[model samples]
Target: MAEAEFARPIVTVDIVLLTLHEGRLCVALLERSAQPFLGVPALIGGYLHTDEDADAEAAVRRILKAKAGLEGIFFEQLGTFASARRDPRDWSVSIAYFALVPQGALKGAANPLELRPVEAAGELPFDHQEIVTAALARLRGKGAYSTIPARLLPEVFTMSELQAIYETVMGERLDQSAFRRKVNDLDLLEVVEGEKRQTERARRPTTLYRLKTPVAVFDRRI
Candidate 1:
């Protein structure tokens, strides 16, 4: 006897490409070029290609490289959003991924992205707003105690700059001494010997540091 079949849902990956610009957390969006929502801004996403993609991650990498011209950027799976009503075309399943990148990286990409402050991304189509909210929650939750926040900075940055990024992600001020102590205790950074840079906060040369690992998690919050 033959088994009953279920309807296949539309599988895709949506990227929440976030960055800090002018001290504000922003997300990248693109104008829909096709029908149903043509000319309207939406999150960068694409349908999964079974013949070409090895998996969802491959699809995401392909989409980002194709649409945003981005490569070797850090991103993690935020969550899955599957529902019958999210898309007008069909039942949709979106494997959402999020990344925090430096502003300069966007500038260097061959295809520049349209960015909007997270709070102002504004009434996006398809369940994108929900996906964005989830991504932000994950970032804020992991950002408090890990080197994850440093992903927003350049390859190497001053301690002040790292603290500023943390404050930005956490949406509050952090004590300079305390923050420095926490960072040192985590041992997540390595000082760049003979390297110093001037920041807007001061004209004096400041110590530069780089993450020892891509990311690290602590049992406690900073």
Candidate 2:
């Protein structure tokens, strides 16, 4: 093989950070600080620091922390993008990742970080809109049979709040009875003792609950 053909491609990491805001799904984006799309909205990303980062995951963690002021978020590798024209600089490949964080966690993040509704997000630089779309699809698909969406909620939540989070991701209204029954059967939640929440519409305080286990993958879709 020709040496030119074997030249290593530039590698980068991009993260689609998602959180729920005002009952809508939102994604965190950063405005590019340098050229090659200067001042344009883009996913939080950077070239992999081979000397410092131990792996792709480590690179993503560093990128999120530096760009979004986020750490210890629940993230998973969504996929990779290697389109020849994706990057204007050179032949590059980006290992894409998606993270879920509770909105409360981002209370004091740094400036230039914007959280826009996923559906209303305008054109993003370098196929980033496509990446966010793929991430949302993965999240919704996984929500059906897994406990992934629970990560978007606080440590303690009411069943109604849990159901609302699922509904927000699924983009549909679920049958309350059926939803509760399915959740109960999964054995994933534990009731919080003597804890309840009262909303303006509710005459009584609703019991609070939390996940009994971190992750749950159901054998059948609920």
Candidate 3:
């Protein structure tokens, strides 16, 4: 007897949610629209198109734009999953990706569903809860040594704002003197002239600083 085609090709996309909320790192969560865990909270994702190119990054980007109507986000491939039973559907393998998008950009008009940001401890639906946990953990690790947090900031912001992002991701408060020391030592930022905005407080207005180079300019290891 000839061998039958026992398994089918499985393609899917998963997006990593990143945002700043209440001076903390927040992740986007959604209610599942279909079965396998219908109505449960999870990250936004969908199936891939077989007819399209095999570029995993591009595929995820398209899904994000189509589903969330967001673009120009800093996305990176976390890894791949091929667990025989990861998906209840006939042995499907998925390429998992994560993204870092500024909070303001999410307000774009193209967005369909209200992508809400979640803070504090909570449970997410499906394997998605695990995916978000893992992705955030990875980003936190990178945060300690890399400038990934800058991706969550505006083009120009105060040093205090930058420090707040790091503290939010790290889930703790940082020392003012030391934090300033670290950023200055890194030499990763460039001060922009003029256009300074004052804060609600009566203290001296903080100067706005912008990234000196693209993320690619920095070593992956930090």
Candidate 4:
């Protein structure tokens, strides 16, 4: 008797949907309904269809929509996870795609499309914890030297709010003076002509600002 070899490999597509919710970095997670991890939280994913092309983008869109009931979102290929023992059921290789969406957009949706903040370290069923860690590192690295961080911000926000978002994502407190200087030098923000009213605070409202232009830089080394 000899060991048997399979004719084909099992391929899967996993999605890591990332977003900023109320100044906290969050990711969309789903509860798995199948075996080998049934009832545990997993990224929205599925087996690749034979009829469909091996195009990662198309596969991710299909999986995201089917699992998360989400569509028309932006995604970037993170990397492939092909460990021989990553999946227990069979020999499976998963291609990971990371999606970034605005917070509050998918709130109260179907199938537990809830957003969980990435700030606190928690338990993730699969290799999702690794995937999330890598994705956040990429985002932080890209934010320092690029304008991708702006995407996580709103259409109009105060300078403090902008800094807060960045600080939260970077997991570090930034020097207020230095932060303002860097942002102003970048000239990426356009001062909106109005101030946001703040009733809770005893001080006056701060001026609001918007992104001056769309960013073309895509280098992930922020």
All models: lDDT?
A: 0.87, 0.87, 0.71, 0.73
- For model 3, the stretches where C-alpha displacement exceeds 4 angstroms are 1-4, 109-121, 216-222
What TM-score does each of the candidates earn?
0.94, 0.93, 0.85, 0.79
Model 4, runs deviating above 4 Å: 1-6, 21-23, 50-54, 119-121, 193-205, 213-222
Q: Write the per-residue lDDT of candidate 2 for residues 103-211, one digit (tens) a residue.
A: 6687645556788998888899888988999999999899889988989998899888899999888899999999999998988899999888997768999898998
**Any idea what lDDT model 2 has?**
0.87
Pairs that collide in candidate 4 are 141-222, 142-222
Task: Show how many residue pairs clash in every candidate, following the order shown.
Answer: 0, 0, 1, 2
lDDT of each residue in 1-222, candidate 4, tens digit only: 334753456788887787787667887778888887898877778888879846878888777776666677667788888775778866668888777766656653457765688655367766778877887888777667766566666567778777877777678898989888877776677877756646344288777888776553533322
| CA deviation > 4 Å runs, candidate 1 | 1-5, 108-112
How well does model 4 score by local distance difference test?
Answer: 0.73
lDDT (Cα, 0-100) at 1 in candidate 1: 36
Worst 10 residues of 3 by lDDT: 109-118
What C-alpha lDDT, on a 0 to 100 scale, does residue 11 get in candidate 2?
Answer: 89
* Candidate 2: residue 216 Cα off by (Å): 1.0
Model 3, residue 188: distance off in Å is 0.7
